[model samples]
Target: MSSEVLVEKRKLKNPPLNIHTLGDRVLRQSAKRVSKVDDEIRELARQMLQTMYSADGIGLAAPQVAVGKQLIVVDTDPEEPANQPIILLNPKIRRHSDDLALGQEGCLSIPGVYLDVRRPAQIEVAYKDEQGRPQVIVATDLLARVIQHEMDHLTGVMFVDRVENSLLLNQELTKQGFSKQAVKPVEAA
Candidate 1:
């Protein structure tokens, strides 16, 4: 939770990065790990935060903005100006609690499509901060859920793909004018 990558948590009329939507090939490709957490990466994280705020989202991954890097930004309490956003470079989940929680999730990449996804109730994640210093955090509840959802983007997995109800998934996508064919489903665990 470095404040180094902090940006004014306000909606930008025009966000720095353009979010690629569903059916875009960029959203399907796995992201590469960041070799260095330099100023360039910090800038990307800042812009991503701005974009996420503009879109009224809690978290965002680099891949969502068509950047093939294992970077993610999360600010669950965006309404709180003093809350520092989490800028994770090359984030990896170190551990997850056995308890599973089913919650509704929405993605900036796939707007207007919210669906239920089951994930670990808690997670321990290891990642590099904006200054290249290593950091580890244990997140639970909404923070855990948002981090998991954004992490899925790094591996080109959308929340819609993890959704169990095919009928509702298809229906929601259709209503949003998105083709159901765009979804590449993940086999249930």
Candidate 2:
């Protein structure tokens, strides 16, 4: 089966999946690797894409929807109908550039909270396409940052965890009706 999934990049009245928010235990649990790429996985990816678009998000992960599969859907240019969304199964960052960049990021799981986080500006990722064929790509800039951000969800890590400014994080979380305690801060590498 071709990895291409044809989904209109628009919000649906009701997305196929429910996106869990921050402080939800489901978001903190690690995702399991997909052993097989089949129709079931494809359908799940389709639903995830719909949910992401519905939530006005450029990327989404299975764990965000309370699924434990190591899957992620990303569409950086949703306005372009010709642009196909990326679906990766068990994606791994094979290599990263020494250079880093700070970019603001927001999550579907944690709505209304955008903060600056530093990440490698470029990365080489290896993963299986929707058809289960192994593939690799070197991504940079926005695409690289989005990929890294979504991949973090697979390991139960949220962008807020990487946020360095505690005051801003707390203010944003509070303003968004989220608790600061929900953030599990990670040390900068």
Candidate 3:
């Protein structure tokens, strides 16, 4: 995270943006592609990062905050003093590895409901930087998972929608006070 734009700079006393929860119509809406990455987009990214930190989240997408733009902020390393948060604008997956792995995942929107979801072990993504420059990253492990998970948001998909364990998914969503009907299960490919 840059010193000037760190979440701390936003003063967590109150996050400027509100994260929409599961079953919300906003989360179901697909985000629009950002044609320009200007100060407005950068500010939204910063605010999203702030809200994520406040909610103890590692990744967040524009749709989570009801912003219909293809923007995402990810901080795979939040505990480390040198936090490296990634700001991606209009991200698109270019390629993904054949290997798939199941990982436990949770969401800021669907609080307290964590479940296992399968995802590609590695991926190559093309996205614009905060400054509007094109960039690509080859990520593996947690980084790969985070990118995929957030990308799903861009297309109006939630992690629960990909969970194969219907039993566990129902149990967790019920326990978290979220409706099971909110989940739209997609058969894994």
Candidate 4:
């Protein structure tokens, strides 16, 4: 085959997909914690952000792209340019408010599934920024929800696991005409 053909074939091989549904081992396994901010990690973050934007998603976890690392990219500004993406490495919620709010949450890993998950109205997060500098950000409302949702991926937790009502899950399945068996029970470690 010609070089051009080879390049095209490689591109076709890695075509993006809406990572809905479950059974992907990457989504189930706990991601490894990132230790250092190296060029590779930064590049990975950039690529992840590109993938998320291409997929028209608000956030993405490393595991979603089959990278078992504690890294996530989120961009919630609908009107702003996509160049500014938030990268979180070794992120941890330092504090969360007692006030809880339920919001419809979705995930790139679990496509076609959205449910009302209860989360804190506000949270203080300590994480490494894109430059690998340690930074703490106080997030509220949707931003807080995005942070909590992505952090769960690092611990092998999906939004469905936090559903407030089982009926909501069933309703989503019914709407999609997908059987309930699609969501397998997450095995205990």
Which candidate ranks first by TM-score, i.e. highest? 2
Give the CA lDDT, 0 to 100, for residue 69 in model 3.
94
User: By descending lDDT, how would the candidates be arranged?
Assistant: 2, 1, 3, 4
Write the residue-wise lDDT of candidate 4 on 89-174 in tens digits. 98999999999998898876666778888889999999987667788999999999998888888877877777757787988867
TM-score of 2: 0.98
- Per-residue lDDT, model 2, residue 112, is 93
> All candidates' lDDT scores?
0.92, 0.93, 0.88, 0.73
**Candidate 2 Cα deviation (angstroms), residue 86:** 0.5
Q: What's every prediction's RMSD, in angstroms? A: 1.2, 1.0, 1.9, 7.4
- Name the candidate, 2 or 4, with the larger lDDT value: 2
Determine which window of 10 residues in candidate 3 has minimal summed lDDT. Answer: 1-10
Off by over 4 Å in 3: 1-4, 9-11
Better of 1 and 2 by TM-score: 2
The positional error of residue 157 in candidate 1, measured at the CA in angstroms, is 0.6
Candidate 1 lDDT by residue in tens digits, 134-164: 9999999999999999999999998988999
TM-score of each: 0.97, 0.98, 0.94, 0.81
Model 1 gets an lDDT of 0.92
Model 1: worst 10 consecutive residues (lDDT sum): 1-10
Cα miss at 99, model 4 (Å)? 0.2
Candidate 2, 33-142: lDDT as tens digits: 99999999999999999999999899999999999999999999988987889999999999999999999999999999999999999999999999899999899999
Q: What lDDT tens digits, residue by residue, belong to model 3 across residues 54-114?
A: 7888999999999999999988877765667888889988999999999999999999998
| Backbone Cα, N, C clashes tallied per candidate | 0, 0, 1, 1
What ranking of all candidate models by TM-score puts the best one first? 2, 1, 3, 4
